[model samples]
Target: MITSAVRQALRTRGDEPAVLCLIGDLGPDRAELAALRLRGNDRRVDLDAHGMGRPVTVEGIGGEGEPSSVGLVVIAADGLTDLRRAVTVTTQLPPTAHLLVVVRHVPAHLGPLVPAPPTIDEWNDLHELRVRRFGNRGWACELCFPGGMSVAEALAAVVHGPRGRRRGPGVGVLGGLSGTQAALWRPGDVAARGVTATGPVEIDRVTPVSDLVLRLDDGGGLPFWEDVEVPAVDRLATDATVAPEVRSPEARLRVYGTDPVSRVAPVDERFVNPIGFTKKTKGPLGELVEVEGRVVVRDETCVRIRPTPDGTVTENDLERVRHLRGVRVGWPEHGDTATVRIVAALAAGGVPLIGDPAPMWAAGLGAPLAELIAGGAEDVLLDPLRREEHSIRLRRAALRTHGVRTRWRSLAAEAGLPVPPETRVSVVLCTRRPELVGFALAQIARQRHVRFEAVLALHGFSADLPEVDAAVAEFRATGIPLVVHEAEGEKVFGAVMNDAVDRASGTVIAKWDDDDWYGPEHLADLMLARAYSGADVVGISQNFTYLEELDLTVWRGYRSEVPSPAIVGSTILADRVVIEDVGGFRPRPRAIDSQFLLAVTRAGCRVYRTHGFGYLLRRAGGGHTWNVDLGYFLRNHTEQWIGWRPSVLLEGVPAPFGAQADRHIDHPGEHVERL
Candidate 1:
């Protein structure tokens, strides 16, 4: 029987599917078996295809009193003719409906079209379906599942398999990976096409339990509807730390991050507060790096403050000092009382102040500006709003920096291996927005790490556009290997992206949105995280999506829920191998990222999140193919704070804010419903 967890996961309403029908000239036993296959969930109107000729039509089934309200169509295939008839009938289905095909055998001629299961077609005497695939869209049926008698019993067999069945005496693959996932999956091969099976094995597991490769449920097992690959972020984390390492007593911490100052214009009112101006606050820059020598290495975040020759604290410079990732203070040569009180203000605000700036001196903190005055002159820190908003933000960022620094130090000390594996990346850019594409292409060029290539898929008019041609020309001029794939059609986001992946030669495939801000070190950091974590996909742990029109920062869930994770986000970098196994992205245009993430996870591939890459996601308002509209975002997402970031003003795309996206205005507290 399925365990409680599996049951909860596969929860069903048990209502009759809207329209269930019998297709082709089938025996009575086939229909009964189909109903029995559904068992507890059986509620179908056996659509009698009485008068429907060779190529069955939806109209023919409805005329015979079958409920024409189609939601699902179930067909039992007895032979080659039945299969072809079902394939044809499916074309008439509403785009949203699903079709279930129960096939005893597939026509050998059609074998090439299917990524048919290894040698399953060779088994002539089998009584049930062994593998499944769609002609082009969505799921079709396999009536019978792997290694079980009937459909229901096959589903119940999922959680009953024995785990930790390893050849070695110690523990199994699950034992190597310690977590809830390990407990749920067994290390040994559970299915007939086991990991060790000869012939075609799609992808090998890095570690047995971590692999968790799921086959397409052809026949049975708790709704084995799709093949899945769940990424093991936790496994990546543990493996990174525990892997064997060589002695490197003096490994220096490398500084890798992109500053937001160049992108941000000081003119925006949001950056200019009543007391001071603001610079973007970066996260987790305070990781420990091994520097040679054992001279009392205390902290990674400490930064020594540098001042002007005159040594007087400026009004705007206070925010600069606050933005620094450390707390240890080192006075300038021409130090004055003003700089002292700025430290005093920071200390009074509960920001940690340390006695020594050992680590700080090494990190180089120099210069000052007018952002937040370090001068205790006007006592601007006394302003209640300033104190509530600015001070809290400063304190929180400093604390997080301190915490990350400490954690890294501990990890570095415990790590067995000196380094992790690095995978080459191929960034897939599929878009109709030429300008944004150019901008994204430029940003890709800015990445510090050069172990990558850009595979761009331009659809519709973009393929032939002159401006796009020039941009492509310019990118190739830089000696970067750029490959462009073009198709003439309306947008299908998933399909286009999948096409790009098919052309990519990199070890990791990075999915990038047309419009988003990524720092120069973005690719480097993602690769570094991938090496250190061994995660299938590495992305920034946390990200914020800003609405350009509303000037509001939107979030769907807790801003802090994902901390130091091992997966990628919408702009993701996934293992090219895993992408192949999961069949790349889905076919639809809308909600494609969501669909991709779900299918990959279901296929037992791991998605892990890493520290931030100075990532900022943007929503340009309505006309967006996906769900990030002003109304949808405001209604669905929780507002983190009233904040805005620099605009992605780049070349190939249109006036990004105008024709590309729609905007909604709030007129002095206008009701949302009215808008």
Candidate 2:
């Protein structure tokens, strides 16, 4: 498809200078093949495939030396990152240059080839590409090259011809599967089944005027033959046998999607609104939908319902519940698969589901999540505090069990793929308090499902201190690697952290706090979020805080699991390369976490905030670098507990060493100083 596009461009340009810029994961072998194919047609076409940072020379193809202007620029990109690189290269080219962008996997929603206005950096470039509206030209799909048309003909239609008429919103089904297994799926669902699926195709709304409509009868009572406009189906083709009466001979179907799993990534509740919606004034209840003889509540109120249709819930249904504060799920009679899928969708978004525990547990939901399921709608609907607490616990369960990555991992295992290797993490703990060293190391020791090393940076203290030596010895006995670094007393906090990081050897680095409480699966959960979200940095929100002086545990309902500008400093876990790319930790005495997050964001790197279920930040009187007062946490808290009540996800975590003594310390400032 790429070679044909190139050939057509050459035909139109004639003797004009042309350059082909290959970007992304297109391997050297594929690049060489593409170059060879282009050159084989004509010896005059001098093309060399270069990596993004390298310069491309259009020597003999354009002129004797480097040509000042090129008539045509072909950019073939593999993914979003490559597209950003293409955008950069386009800016350097002549304004009059005819641009052609070929993406291997075009997002289903992109309508045209015209790129959005470029941003100041690559991260913004990617964000723009994701959310920007597209026009009807400038991009072509390698997968959906129109059949029976020459490259020149297709290019003319795509670039110079009139814009294609926009189809109605909803799915335009072209073919039918055998027997009663016919399922009306969105583009993402089809893509997950290894078929090329495209669209913002709404399954609930399909029009007879749709170019390639399929007649679906799933044996359910719901109306399947209703004539409704399915707006904006760019193109879709399925391998299922075509229905003779509905098939259009001239109408070509093209489906596009990144992946089925990735389709849910945007809706992953963890990454949605991190701020708690509990404090907001309640709005009027919205429309309600009935399914399976039950009133499945659909409203703008605090408690929403995830309406399960007769069959599987469509992508549109998922979108409806995406921002919901809490979802009330009722038993769906639609088989086990549908039930599991519905729960997964709800849980994946970090939204708490209020339903009977028995059904959810039968469907394989384990503890904490099962515990979160309310006995009845009235249990949480009448109490905002109960709902908010449930949301926190549910978010934690989502990270550990219901995440998209976790689901895929389970599927992969069922298919008999080899288990993936555990991610290696270097825990960097920098602190001035010698008494809290053992307490912090104990938290690191409890971490599971990851290979970890401890890098203890004793800021303003010597390693020879008995407390420091004893903590190191105990941690090393756990068989995990330990590296101790002692920074001079005068060193800045950020400088001390960098020194410790320098001595660490792990693919990923996790910043640890000496005085904070962490769950056993904290690092593992961060790893899961990292793998699924593809963010440069991952961290938990500072949701749970223990006010030592007041003997109160405050649950600050901070938004989590979404891309944000910043996350709690100590909860940060980032790949070493990403940290290095952003120039490591800034050399500052205070607010280094915020500073580092800012630097990375400006560098076009993503910062993802995962759940705060496993981490509990400690706030004593003065002495801390964060320096926020006790009342600040109290003011923002959605709920408060009298004793030390962390999320159930932290159940397996051991109690902090010297917990009783540390609680009654006279010099709280000297006893708990985080470097």
Candidate 3:
């Protein structure tokens, strides 16, 4: 396969640096033909053939520690006999290799002794099988069949004596049919896959320039019509009507007579296939033995007939049988030609099939194959651990099967831990644009059902601006007790959050952004979820037309069907103790918030999601964390914090004092000293 692909690729890349390898016994004719095909196509197809000229045997494939170096492998069905060897070759191929396989359907064996529409007694013994060879190969196989000659010739139209000197058209029935009358179109007309004149009354054949065509209605109770192409003739059987009804069980049939045809009678609905074969018993051999069997052919439509004294298996007592179950038995079209050819070439070294064939087989083949494959196995081997999918699914299952159970609030309540009824809720916000501070404070003041203290952390600037001071003064005048914390140090988001948590005297702290507009019922939802989970942290996911349009602080609670926490970021944590215990977040710019959530979650805290619009994240151009590649940072950060790796923390964001931020990686001694 690799050799064929390489040869083909070389031919297509004319004059390019190309190489080819042949393993095992190389057929003289095949090799010569391939060489000729490649050479004639272009100079790039230059055969720089390599590998042991002596046939590379199947055993040599993926030999010991050896790996075949090939860009792409094409396994044509012509050379293969042993499908297992082909699968093995593909399975062992390197990660970068590409593979292609071609498939061809073979005819099933129904013994010559028991002809095709087998006798009731022979139906069970003579099985008509459709072998889906390589039934388990995961490789995509393209099935191709040869198209017939020209359209008219393929349809098999009758021709008259001569074009110029035509014999009188054979007299035949001219039957017409039409669909139900409607404003425009109706599907009342019948079409057929293939049709034949049923009861023939000879008609004169006239040679026309092309195939004759007709569109007419054969008057019947139901409005019906047909578009037909049939050889015209005289002396047609006009006594028979044109049957314009074609069902899978019966074909649209027409009879020709000496006069214009009368209405055509419908064929029995039980008769499948326009063309059929049936034989009636002639001797007492048919009466003594009851013929009771079902024809089981793959691909073709078949009928099952059950036999009884009254319901002796007859042509009329059968129904279409779709799928059949049996061990397929047959050889390729050109026996051992393509199969032997494909197998011989691929056996030398076939591509290692990607993904497990068992599950894929079960999926494609359904219950029968799935049960067969898993008859005696521990479990199906899914995507290997090398794939992110395997690990992700496992993690998700773990979280769902045994979810986080926190002891903080429960233990506190059980141990009669003191409850501060007057506990305040602290709100924190950060913004580069100070002008938006007023709106943020107004929303905070509007929380009628909640009591909370708000803090605005403005970005540190070398020189104080009048606008900043005015925005601070404006927010303070809203009658909402506000603290304008001077963010003078280097901008580290985690550090800023820690500062707000430390300064506020609140039992629960909620995080927020400055520029985001809040939903009126946002605070109420958080309190409700926190009360329900009885946990320190609450989480939720945001629903928005665009991610940037979402309020980062609030989110509609997670859907019940989610089975897991949705938004890990927009969660509320009780007090500063858990936050302080979690080491107060790494001061690095990227993934600080996500990293904090991971720590809280790992610490056995319950996170609940609220439904509806939570909070929106106001996107802006520059921030120490946002300036660099945020996606790259978050992906690594998640892998490190969530997947566990401290070294990931050391790979700090490219920011001022990014190195110095490590000093704050560990919690303040004073905070931990009390814990």
Q: Model 2, range 25-46, lDDT digits (tens) per residue? A: 4434245535544443232211
Error of 1 at 48 (Å): 76
Residues forming the 10-long window of minimal summed lDDT in candidate 2: 160-169
Task: List runs of model 1 lying over 4 Å from the truth.
Answer: 1-422, 462-464, 553-569, 611-613, 628-675
What TM-score would you give candidate 2 relative to the actual structure?
0.56
Model 1 C-alpha lDDT per residue in residues 1-675, reported as the tens digit of each score: 112211221233123232244433333545454534333333333322321111223332345665443333444443322333233233223221333344343322122112122234433333453233433321233322222122112211211111101111111121111211121112111221222111122344552332222121111111221323432111111111112352122221211122211111011111111122222234222211222311111234553223221121222233334443334343433322223323433432233233333222222111121112232222323332222233333332222222222222222233321222334678888777655555566667656544788898887755456556666766777777889998667758778888888898887788776667665556765554443233455566333566777666654432211212323345577677777777877788777766667776777554545433246566775556565436755665533556553212111121212221222222212211110
Worst-scoring 10-residue span by lDDT in model 1 = 262-271
TM-score of 1: 0.38
> lDDT for each of the candidates?
0.38, 0.52, 0.31
Question: What are the C-alpha RMSDs, in order, of all predicted structures?
Answer: 24.5, 15.8, 33.7
Q: What TM-score, over all chains together, does every model reach?
A: 0.38, 0.56, 0.29
| Candidate with best TM-score | 2
Residues 1-675 of candidate 3: C-alpha lDDT, one tens digit per residue: 324434444454423222222221222423643554433212211111110011222222235764332323333322211121122222212221222333221112100111112124422332222212332221122111121011111111111100011111111222211121110010001111111112121233753221221122222221221213333221111112223352222222342222111111111111111011111111111001112321121222322322221111111121111111111112222221111111111111110011122322112122322233223121212212112112122222221111111111221233334333434678877655444454455555555446677777775642145555554555556566677677756767777777766777776787775444345445654654454233446654442211231211111212321213446353343445667768876776567767777787777654444432334433333443434333422331111111111111112111111223223222212211110
